[model samples]
Target: MNELLKVNYDSDRITLSARELHEFLGVKTKYKDWFPRMCEYGFSENVDYRLVAQKRATNNPKNPYTEFNDHEITLDMAKEIAMIQRSEKGKQIRQYFLELERKWNSPEAVMNRALEYSRKQVQALLQTNEKLELENKIKDQQLNELKPKADYYDQILQSKSLVLISQIAKDYGYGAPTMNKKLHELGVQYKQGGQWLLYSKYQNKGYTHSRTINITRSDGRSDVRMQTEWTQKGRLFLYELLRKNGILPIIEQN
Candidate 1:
């Protein structure tokens, strides 16, 4: 029922003039300078205040016909002004302004903002879901291309056996270096002595097989060297590991 509370308090288009505001709250400060300083303190025009041209007082001899700018402030801006005034009247009006604000910003206004935010969040989630579906379609298409060959290997993978590096590459349609790179990524490091050995954690894990081969050097010296192969379990393990990571092996046909 207060004079300040009686304005065109439209839900989304609420505003009040500076003169009307000062008169209602009994603010006697020279507001011409004060309002600009208040705006400088992070209050934005149109968002917090709007400057409008009003005709000067008819009694003014020199400026009666001229237009002067008056600020039409939002409730939020009025509250800010009340907070900055260093007087008991300021404190009283601040409390009164708070009550007015509660009436204006309570239930319905708060719900409108909340609903708008929820709508945006839902739209974002829909966009993200669409992107994921597109990626899944591409991945499914790639997997379909490999399905015919992958079916045969799926059978061979069930047998208990050890295969040489060359055989592994041949079966998986990859180079020896690429096979080794994948093994390394799976935490299977080549030993320091230039022999392919599983790391200590994978030792005796039935992931590897080895053999010794004798070769004569250029100096007519023959040395026995060890060669490592992948076990059936190891092959199956690598296959699944590579497949799950989006790496598809080219299937070799008989």
Candidate 2:
């Protein structure tokens, strides 16, 4: 709650500027002279302190910009140096650092840090999910842009091959009854007494043919029936007609 001296808690370590510490403690000796004397107390470089650059004004018109060496000493080193000072300001700064360290390592502080880490992970996951959703949307848009062209190619290739009504229905993810019903609704064909036949307008388009089948009824009476089958042209016609009405085979669906 009170500021005694500036403390740096960056670089994954708690540290203090040695020069700032000297000025705060009101040391009468020059920093260049005082710091060397402090180092004589068996303190090690990079372990007890790290060398850092401190910019300075040379106070000369010829070379105004210059630099001086400084050190960022760990809190433990700073506490020891304060004790070595054996002065009123040194005692105050040392006690301030002790209290700060106690609070920094408290259980409440640790839990807060863990919660902050969890929040960061959740944010990262949400960002990743958003990216994937955008990618899928783009893919769907590209597929929709190309669907009509792909369906045209499919019709060209498939219509060249003879196929059964049930097989064609299967390709569209439906059954014969559904296909027949759809074709009937579109005026492409009609159901007669016992079979489906092309409408009069489409009958002479070379799209279909009727085959006569001889079968024995369950009563052992012989009967003849007409089975109408589609040609490749008829299948292609159906494809274009269905596509115009916004019905598509499974292959052409998004």
Candidate 3:
């Protein structure tokens, strides 16, 4: 491993010793001559390379007691140096360094993978929500299908001699004003002489039924007033008449 490359981890970035890189590149020339020539290629200091220097004794015997500067360069600077060298070894070293870089795991790659995983999770959740919404819609349709039978049980099974005009309108899901409008279209006028009366043609058909009630006020004045009402059969007759003329009861929709 030392012969090929000596690798180090610093803050998750891969670094190589400058002396080891020079030796591995097998440059026969002095490092001082090679280093300055590579720097002239415009590689910025501290970005492509970080130099670590210390004072060292000179090689001269008389100057052995004195000191000189020694330094190191980074892997980027080494790659640039390898590219410039005109030798088969330099080409081999450059290829090997590229392979190392390709194999390295980066923080950006990890973050991108995490984002992709989150997107998949969100897509799955949306699909599930759409499925649930469709299921709920099906349930609502089924409930609507059962509504007419429930209305029949209330209107027919619970038989009564008479049902108020207001109750009949409610069962058909009509307000008083809308019901009056429909009745008017059928030639039946309401609350005249306090009685629901039909026009000439419908009068003989007996589509309407009413009764009279006598009431005495506190002043001792008694009066006979006709109260408007509908029987079960009368209610059915009106329902059919209005429906045939393109006016349908709400239950018919279900």
Candidate 4:
């Protein structure tokens, strides 16, 4: 609003009138707070506030101007004054002003503009977060819907009725170890019971049913049975096995 002050937007520079500089440096006692505190550190007002040759010539010439405004102040002039006032006590104040000027004119302003752009991008992401979450939920529901049908096919292959490991190996056209590994991957369990029974399912003759087999242990001491029905004991045993192996998935209770 001051007539003698002009701000250049393209250069980001401010031109200050002599009167404004005098007022800012507190040449008058009314605005003492605006004065640089270096005035206390051997910074006599006479040395810091002086009239430049150009500023001396005014329309009146009789009353030579002794002050210059912020725009009239150059970077070199500010640095020179700061260097003269350099002392342990004034170091912080000097550095503060130096850094303030550096930030105002340096590439940091560009960085701040970039930071503002990134903040807007983050705001946009947050705005659509709910829609993204809803899409994820729909995908999860579709996965859940297809899960039972896949489980049905898996049950047919791992039927508990296929007692002997060799039988499952024969049906699946895989080796015993491969069959065992497949069953292990599918979380199939074998139970010791009245007879050697196989409980895995096999898709045969256009129908899927539990396959059963009767067999004796190699030692003749125990009979084993495999089944698809997951019992409380079976579940507990499976849970313990998985826990021991560190493969257990967390189960939520109703």
Candidate 5:
């Protein structure tokens, strides 16, 4: 806890630098020679301690960098090495390590660790909620952009009123007479004595409705005639028929 020998807490278990431990214990032998001998006393390689390669500047300038090996031994192994030294410094280090092990496993330390874990979980959940909210906002914007088209299509389907030929023709960028000529050319209608009528093939198809109208000419005489108007179904039929011929309404073209 007071930085006695720079212990490593990066791993799940506490580990000590074996070279540092040797120096602190005042071993007579050099680290390269002393560490191997310490391993000989029933200490396994990776289970008790692991080797770490490090680089440093050398005294000789010609070979400026040199690589050396150090070991990270567990607390249990360090304690064992300290006891084997049979010195006052070794006893003191061993006592310090024992205290560290006790505090590290205490209930207070465990509770602190649990609270830290819960804090991290809550932070992660908050970030996820922000992301979901952003996604929903984008989806709502997309639906809003499509709403006008949906409303227009619904109006077209629900209309029950009859439309004049001129009105349908205007939608297709055509005047009434031009539209009639085109329809006659397409074999859908024919010009009779006083009016345009659907061809025999298209007659009685519920595409048109005849309304009787009384007209007064410039001669002060009145006349009765049947005026043909297109129903919604007939308008839709003309839309499809004209669309196949590469014709489209102004609204559709826009």
Candidate 6:
């Protein structure tokens, strides 16, 4: 067998035997037909005979093989071969041959190295996915815990009691104007009589209801009566009343 036909069992460098190299280069002719042409063209006597023969056989017959084999392989030829072998479309073909060569002739260390690299990449991707899943679960749990309190606050704001609105705001830590702004958004209405009265449209159809609240002073001598009616200014006043009394709940807004 030719020296070029012998495989190196230790080298990691990609290599090809003379016959194999010829096949890779796509030479259609036989080695016997090509070796003499290389010699006639001044290929070195020391040149790998099989490689030279394959090259000669593959040369276009129209352009007879006159180029010297003794000439060093140019950088352009090396680049051309690399481009063809390493292209995206050629990845599978190159990897298949490379793995086969590694399995057959390379050391066990090389195979182990490749396997270790692949394992590390898989482990990293799994860890990242797990962390994202854990964060999403925590966010969902937090939302579940706060939803009921928020709903309760909404119900209170939508109720038809000025006293209750003020109490809720004070309990929940909302300022008067802020609480009133929220009430207005919910379409609740307020009216001023002796004091402020808040009402909901659904509770008092046709805006006619006599939901009255009376405030008695601490001296036990002064009494105040407030009647409910629907108006924007009344609602604002009711908000002020609730805020001044410190009755807004902090839970409703958040």
Compute each candidate's TM-score over C-alphas.
Answer: 0.38, 0.45, 0.35, 0.21, 0.47, 0.34
Best by TM-score: 5
**Clash count list over all predictions:** 1, 0, 0, 20, 0, 14
Candidate 6 local lDDT, 7-47, one digit each (tens) = 43332233344344344445556645643453454434333
- Model 2 segments beyond 4 Å from truth? 58-61, 116-254
Question: Tens digit of lDDT per residue, candidate 1, span 176-227?
Answer: 8877877788676665576878888877878787888897888999888888
User: Model 5 reaches what TM-score against the true structure?
Assistant: 0.47
> Would you give me the overall lDDT of model 1?
0.73
lDDT of 3 by residue, 99-199 (tens): 66665545775676567779888999999999999999999888787677467546644776776667767767887667877787677764575466767
Q: Give the C-alpha miss distance for residue 62 in model 5, angstroms.
A: 5.0
Query: Order of all candidates by lDDT, from best down to worst?
Result: 5, 2, 1, 3, 6, 4
The candidate that achieves the highest lDDT relative to the unseen native structure? 5
Please identify which of the two predictions, 2 or 5, would achieve the higher lDDT against the true structure: 5
How much lDDT does each candidate structure score? 0.73, 0.85, 0.69, 0.45, 0.86, 0.48
Residue 195 displacement (Å), model 2: 65
Query: Candidate 3: where are CA atoms >4 Å away?
Result: 1-150, 204-206, 216-221
Name the weakest run of 10 consecutive residues (lDDT summed) in model 1.
4-13
Candidate with better lDDT, 3 vs 4: 3
RMSD of each: 13.6, 13.0, 18.4, 18.2, 9.9, 15.3
Q: How many backbone clashes does candidate 2 have?
A: 0
